[model samples]
Target: MADNSSGGESTFTVLLALGANAAIGVLKLVAGLLTGSAAMLAEAAHSAADTTTEGLLLAALRRSGKRADRQHPFGYGKERFFWALIAAVSIFVSGGAFAIIEGIRTVLGEEAEQTLAWVAYAVLGVSFLLEGTSWLQAVRQVRKESAAEDLGFFAWLRRTDDPTVVTVCCEDSAALIGLLLAFAGVGLHQLTGSGIWDGIASLLIGVLLTFVAYVLGRINKGLLIGRQADVRLVRSIRQRLDGHEGISGVVDLLTMMVGTDQVLLCARLDFDDALGAADVERLCVRLENELREEFSDLDEIFLEPVPREDPDIRARVLERYGENPLSTRSAPGGATRSETPSGE
Candidate 1:
């Protein structure tokens, strides 16, 4: 099932992030103590925050996968969004805020540059390797899913309806950039014999983390508020309905994503008058059955029928719905008046 697959992927991604963070944290902590580099210390804090967030994400994934209960009719799907928000907050407070403070102290000349700074550089190099591996894994997963939907990697990451994958990718990328910043800072400190360079690097790393957290927060907000399905998908559904029997054309259509893969659909369809109300009812049933068969992820569907012989009916429906109606509309003066807004 889609839910099962999603849960599994989330679990794997969380573990991957946690594993990488743990390794990097150890390296950074050791490097920071040996070289006393502000940037290295900042990076260690970032890694620590990342590890904590990963643990929270895993818990959220498990809770979100729970079945619907009497208290929560929609299930615990929104739990992911809640935890994602918490993770972003953690990044901002633990990583961004702390780095900024440390960078300021270093810049104020309160701290002295460590003479033996090579250790920081060595640790940064190793951290980069580990972070890069984690990033690659997340990218690979996104690519696999995106390819099925005919999207490029970055485009997919931006447009993906799944917040968990987006969050993981964003965090990994920020961490990779932080490693580079630390390397640059330590290298400069070694060259200039000044701790200010290290401080500047920490500040920059904080800025990057803040930016990434903001983006992730925006994505999670959209997911929580509920976003409409892609327009192209709605058009495809319309095409399908147009092909059905007794259905003249699609008048109106609306779709919203219920979850990552699930969708809710509502449509207004035109039916030939030759088919009475009973016949139209049967046609509606058939159309619903066909759609369900075609798109297994469709959750709820609503079909409204209108008489096809009315000249202005389709126009009115189109005007109101902003899509071509499945059936034709009635003219201005006729027995079956245009009850709805027409595209006159």
Candidate 2:
């Protein structure tokens, strides 16, 4: 559910990575076969894994965009998160595991003659250029998104609901580092006439891939478990609700990121007591329309009218916030109207 421009950027980035990794994978495989360098072979597997990851990301973008249906009233936004999780697993199994096993085999087996050391060096040079190109594109997209959100780069990354860009960026970064490790292994093996250095480089590449996989896996796991929406978005919504005229107080506000740019929100509000039921219904309809106009990401909303001083409600809010709940007033029946400044 990312906006049109954002969704287009994500697709373009994935395609660029897919093309780069596909070409690099072929080149690395040829070089590895000719030189018998475990590190080079590991790099080849790494490229293959990256290529697969890009494909899966493409599917994620496509499927997650599906329109809402009977069974899935909330739509298919979380499909992106599910596929991203699978892509992380692919990195570990196809790339990391293969590299570790190959490293062990080469280290324990007989020495391999470095016939095409020059070929590996040439491939590495070209691969670096390709990978660098892909990496720059990902970085540019990340920076643009961060700026739009008025947040720092790393902060945006942590809070971003989109997974395709993150997946591509991380994969490309690991690819670049793996290339360097392969270069070192190939260079050292040729210089010393020992495959041990080559095996060591392969092991390092495995560890690098494993770490990337773990980081990505943890992120997607949190998303699948339903993380809260962006802090800024939540705070803005709360502030808007507080300033509304008829709304005496906001009892509870809940938000969840259902998809890349889609949010599900529920707000329990205390309206003016003198208002009639018909007036309250009209206000509810108007408020929903106004909120949707202001916040395009709000995909679904539920508004409940409740007394602000309800004991059970107060108790539940206290348990969640532990004294600093996101309400206009500090306590029940405290401030008649909100005096706290915006962004509190």
Best candidate (score: TM-score):
2
Clashes of each: 20, 0
- Model 2, span 1-344: residue lDDT tens: 23547999999999999999999999999999998899999999999999999999999999999999999999999999999999999999999999999999889999888887999999999999999999999999999988887878888778899999999999999999999999999999989999999999999999999999999999999998887777778888988887998887788887888888998998989998988999999999999999999999999999999987777876776666555434344544454433222224
- Writing each residue's lDDT as its tens digit, candidate 1 over 1-344 gives 13336657767877998999998898898989888899999999899888877887887777776876899765676687788888888888898889999898889867684856778778888888888888887887887787877878888777776677787888999999898898889988888888899999999988988898788888778877876666556666777886777776565566666666666788877776578878888878888898888877677788988555445755655465554344345633453323222212
lDDT of 2: 0.89
Q: What is the lDDT of residue 289 in candidate 1?
A: 94
Q: Once model 1 is optimally superposed onto the true structure by TM-score, how far is the C-alpha of residue 328 displaced, in angstroms?
A: 11
Find the 10 residues in a row with the least total lDDT in model 2: 335-344
Root-mean-square deviation (CA) per prediction: 4.6, 2.6
Error of 2 at 73 (Å): 0.4
Q: State how far residue 134 of model 1 sits from its true place (Å).
A: 0.8
